[model samples]
Target: MNQNVQQAAAPGLGIEVSSKVPMHWYNLNADFPEPMPPALDPATDEPVRPADLEPLFAKSLIAQEFSSERYIEIPQPVREVYSLWRPSPLRRAVRLERALGTGARIYYKYEGVSPCGSHKPNSSVPQAYFNKIEGIERLTTETGAGQWGASLAFACALFGMGSETWQVRSSYEQKPYRRLQMGVYGSQCHPSPSELTESGRRLRGQFPDTTGSLGMAISEAVEVAAKDPRTHYALGSVLNHVMIHQSVIGLELLDQLEEAGEEQADVVFACAGGGSNAAGMMFPLLGQNLRGGSTTRLVAVEPAACPSMTEGEYRYDFGDVAGMTPKLMMYTLGADFVPPAIHAGGLRYHGMSPMVSHAVHLGLIDPIAVDQERSFEAGVAFARTEGIIPAPESTHAIAGALDHVTSGAARPGEVVVIGVSGSGVLDLAAYDGRF
Candidate 1:
């Protein structure tokens, strides 16, 4: 048994916590038939060595990046912090199923219970812990919808560290409260494409009046981290370590399904952004499926406005717009592409996670793109039925499940699980237009 795992239900919030949050996070690398591609340094055109990233990331994180372990033990300090909101409830969306008039049973893993209101903190707490123990004083990173920024900020405050975040410009303007929330958690926040870094300056030169994307924001944040010896970059998604840290979501879901008396989900869904949330929820399922057990269908829902999985090319591409990070083989819509300022700010990234892209390439899961209107409609219907307002990023999942029921593809009594990634309480402005 994992030492930090809770066998008994963690009590709070008047909700049933059916499973323990695992002390060891799962890593799929050991099980993969082929190792993930090694990122190459643009300047040297060589496979990026651990020492090459020493200046930009904690050595511990760098080791985890290349590790092929099936499970990495979560530091006790990190697990202590996770006790605040681990084992988030897996709810059967009975009301939603009835509202949709579907015979398929719908379940959701609600991540909004966390203080940062998303699964971002699942990685943030551990990332902050790694940096703190490594003698790093401050962390720098980028955000799209501010969930990642706010999560890291809260974790840093708990660890008595500091963080600087460059949030996407559109989200900065649309979600002012997220910036204020970061400040409350003792982190400084700035709009991306700010004239603070050379990467930001170069982007400004090209698109002086354009909304910023995650790729652009990552470039700005990486520039700052690479320059300061005391500051290291902490990415929100699309990295191996980040995705591994997020396995807690699926680890809990594994037990939840057993408690719910379901054999396996017929289909599991999550909105794909940089792909952390979907990967987090689906990775364990894939592991089970790969082992010749559980034939659960995995699905990724992406925004049509920035459909990296559905319309992008499968090739080696830079993770950022400025070509600072290593080249990853993933589905990309061109790193330089500036996505339209859609309401689902988090889904505006140009490329998918390499692991997720590889999974799609192998035909392990299916990807579908949903437009703004249908996502919002599904979100509204879910709110009315389930009494929980989902984040715009999560609405894509709702829309995906809704599509199957309406199309008469979902059979009666089939089980469907959706990842309700976060709450939209801070995004009332986006909902105001509807009212």
Candidate 2:
């Protein structure tokens, strides 16, 4: 089908299926997993604990709700912007099923159709809406893979607001297409530690060839946002509000599953960076769990190079792009530890989302970290079978899905849903190397 025709058919008429079982759901609770035991900071050798997260958690955008008529009404402007790419589709992987030759059914909710080509816009649009309503003039943020930067830029454009982005140095250098994409959306992109802020300057002095980390980029963005009263920082992932905004994915998936005549998924999988996309996909599933569905396995996949959930310590750490910002209690690898340059740049973070980390710690969810080569292998397999090239970061989830299927863990007639958070069109170079 043509793009326009497909877009037109997305919401109501594209497919009509029914749910196998009647299931009721509930709203997400504000309460989350308790903090793990504190770890000592390597730099200062001080105890890092959940108590240190008080200030950062207090500032989370998700912690608050919009109180405007437009927020409640969903204005035309907002609808117009969303209609451009809202309501992404949930697709079943028939070809993948043939390839696996397993009795299991595979499905994926595609979020690559967004202007930013990822699920980031789910939050970006709402974030822009609230900020514009609050009379904010500009937005600032850090970008590791450029998906978040592009999403913010697109959202700001919808609101006629300017945006500034500090891209991680490795991503800025390695993914020119991503940087260009951000620029195309009218956001200025600078490599972090570019003498832009005090943090960057100090870091540059320490290591002249430093490739900026998310921690550093966050520091620069926070500096800009805090210094300018008119500007607000927009984060692509983590935080409750961002995850809540992304619930549209799961919400839509529920409707799509009904259309396909499927019931509860046997397993759900999504890539975990800062955890917005994963949480978006799984939270609704968790809601299903709350309603007493049989244990639906929820899996979070991360990069082994930056395995915050699997290998890192849960402790209080700064959430900035640099180590300069206020601390948040989270599972972190270490702010100063630079991860190896991996194709999944977005997954190279040193920390996990507080909510996601909390969930994992409480044993409410499970996490696994995969190496780059294996992830790329899964990406290739998915592209060949499903005819969709997934982002390197998201390929981790695909990798996990493949492992689950190949292990014969899922029986025939069981279902699996993978969140293909973004397309890998901009990542052709990475694929070229793998193929």
Candidate 3:
């Protein structure tokens, strides 16, 4: 057995933990079949340089955003924080498989054990550390489902920095517990389109009764950072560096699977919002495939209500509603598009990550859309069998995995992994009144 791995005491339980955490984060940028499209300055329509992003992001993050290296060393400080919840458990979904009577084996990499109850902290910690070392006093960010806001708030608290977040209006009204969590972490939170910034006011004037979207929230947060020299914008997802920070998920999975005596997963299912969770779970394996090592199918499950990967057009689009941010080539449903207030608030973005979009465009990753009702059904079913209630966003992956198995697409004896990005403890309201 690898020194990093520890098998479960009970054999049939199939739960395994890693004694070690990955010291380096994997980057798919070096192995991408084609270079991803560069972010362009909205004003000049030319490629954005590191200096162009200096106003919004930390210098270290900007280097990562544009880095071509295959692996980057994880700072010891960041790694120390990660050790709190790194090497999260990987378990065989024996009950779930028996419930479905599927021949294929089922496994789930659970990331809810973090202090923030989600995978958002995987990047938030590093983002906070990087900004703190550079003398940044505060961080401004946007969140759709409140997970990112709470995670950033926790990270800022650890690094002794102030955090201000604008959450989507729908989620602000629906998920109050997440807001409370952020407040407990000593961060200020607001509903998007509030009268906080010029962008927010303009959006409110244009759509007075709008429920708000991630794009609008990003504009509000970015506006604040752009105007303040001591503050920097921290994005939860849809950025290259965020994706890289999240790669720890897959790196750990690679070792856990091998230590458990599994060769390779036949397919991996992960929910795609800004694509951070999916990228974190699949990027390492996809890198292997790029190097002609594995044939694992990386599946990105998105909401049918906001199907950026399946229905949106691939093109250069603004990352925010107000056009204050750079434009990147990706699958976009138009920055102005406001999706329905589905329970999966995080997946309601108008655009996918440029890196994920590039993989979709090249056929490296498979994209599928799941309806909200079906997703909730899957969540409820899994809770009954697995005894863990998945977050509304994570239900999309469960629904997708069930869809694949039920559709007879998965071969017998194949191993399938699901990325459970977070827990639904604070999201009980979404499950209220639903079966």
Compared with the true structure, what per-residue lDDT tens digits does model 2 show for residues 300-350? Answer: 999998999999997777665455444556788887867887778888778
Please give the CA lDDT of all the candidate structures. Answer: 0.88, 0.76, 0.92
True lDDT of residue 147, candidate 3: 97
> How would you order the candidates by TM-score, starting with the best?
3, 1, 2
Task: Output the better candidate (1/3) by lDDT.
Answer: 3
User: Which residue pairs overlap in candidate 1's backbone?
Assistant: none
Per-model TM-score on C-alpha atoms: 0.94, 0.85, 0.95
lDDT of 1 by residue, 302-402 (tens): 99999999999998899999998998889999999889998788899999998888888888879999998889988898899999999999999999988
Better of 2 and 3 by lDDT: 3
Cα-based RMSD of candidate 1: 5.0
lDDT of 3 by residue, 1-435 (tens): 342322211112223333487888889999997899899999999999999999999999999999999999988777767877888889999999999999999999999999999999999999998998899999999999999999999988877788999999999999999999999988999999889899999999999999999999999999999999999999999999999999999999998899888999999999998899999999999999999988999999999999999999999999999999999899999999999998899898999999899999999999999999999999999999999999999999999999999889889999999999999999988998779
For candidate 1, the TM-score is: 0.94
Error of 3 at 132 (Å): 0.5
Show how many residue pairs clash in every candidate, following the order shown. 0, 11, 0
Better of 1 and 2 by TM-score: 1
Cand. 3 TM to true fold: 0.95
Compare the candidates by TM-score and give the number of the best one.
Answer: 3
